[model samples]
Target: MPAPTLRLPSGDTWTRAEYEALPDDLPVRVGVVYGELVVKPRPRPIQRRVARRLATRLEDAAPVGWQVDADVDVLLDDDEVEPVELAPDVVVYSSDHDPYERPISADLVTLVVEVVSPFSRRVRPSLYAEAGIRHYWRVETDQTAPAFAIYSYELDDATGLYVATGVHHDRIAVTLPFELDIELKGVREPRRRRRAGR
Candidate 1:
């Protein structure tokens, strides 16, 4: 059987009211990605769990006038295609945010953490870098060794692209607005099975 289809109106810009009127039963999320109304799959359990852990870590480590949110929308433009929804597993925004809604810009964010899913590993980080995000961490939970591989991007003079400056394991600490440290070893992956009767 074929999956149900969603009838998306053809255009570049859409109002929040127009976005809301789409069918609620559709299995897609309507968010703007680079000025287009993009529909993407929702995150799975491992992804959700990673988000929770990162949020907790931030809340504990962050100082006053800083806040964190997960699975929230961020408006990159005035149109409906906001470029980033389902943003950061953990995102740090300035103190003045509306209680009911996500912020409009990726401004004043010190850290943006992404728990890289199998399919999204390559593309997601690049998107974040393009948004002028200062720092990003890519967590890989699907490795044989099961480790969180960290990557840091800094603006380069010649290339005009953010060059990866650091990569580390076991623990990671970022020094942006404040000092924050996370121990990745605390996140345990499921043990692999041995051959039946070895």
Candidate 2:
């Protein structure tokens, strides 16, 4: 039998309330982009591991009055009636801001980090850049090995795009928004469970 066809509202835009009403059981991650609904599959285990490690390192190195959080909603355009909201893998924002009370404004965000999954590789960077976020980091992993690469981007105000700042393979050391050094060797693929007998 063919899979049941699901229907969405007939429009190019949806309010935050409408997006929130989506079924919680949906397997994919959902968000609004340019007032349009966008969905992508959840991150695999390897992506999650890398996200966690990077978030931890950022949090530890963050100076007083700064906060590092993973997987939180950020309203990219506060002026738009139906704004674009992105939940980056990790976000660095002011400690005084309350994320739960309302979506964090892009202006308040100091840095955004995305662990590049197959689905997000192309779109996310442009979106963050368009939103005017100052700093962006893209983490890429090799499926065949534990190795990973970190690509840093800084928003170019004149062009409203991100320009590559640096690319680190084994380690990341930067002083932007804060000073920190992180080792990426620990992020690795998950081991498979063995069967009952060989």
Which prediction has the highest lDDT against the true structure? 2
Candidate 2: residue 161 lDDT (0-100): 90
Across 68-180, the per-residue lDDT of candidate 2 in tens digits comes to 88888788865454768878999999878975655788878889998887657867888788778999998887566355788898988899998899999877899997899
TM-score of 2: 0.82
- Would you list the C-alpha lDDT of every candidate in the order shown? 0.62, 0.80
Q: Point to the candidate with the largest TM-score.
A: 2
Steric clash count of candidate 1: 3
Q: Which tens-of-lDDT digit does each residue in 157-183 have in candidate 1?
A: 465356776676767676754687888
Instruction: Give stretches of model 2 more than 4 Å off.
Output: 1-12, 20-27, 79-82, 144-147, 189-198
Error at 198, model 2, angstroms: 28
True lDDT of residue 76, candidate 1 = 37
Compared with the true structure, the alpha-carbon lDDT of candidate 2 equals 0.80
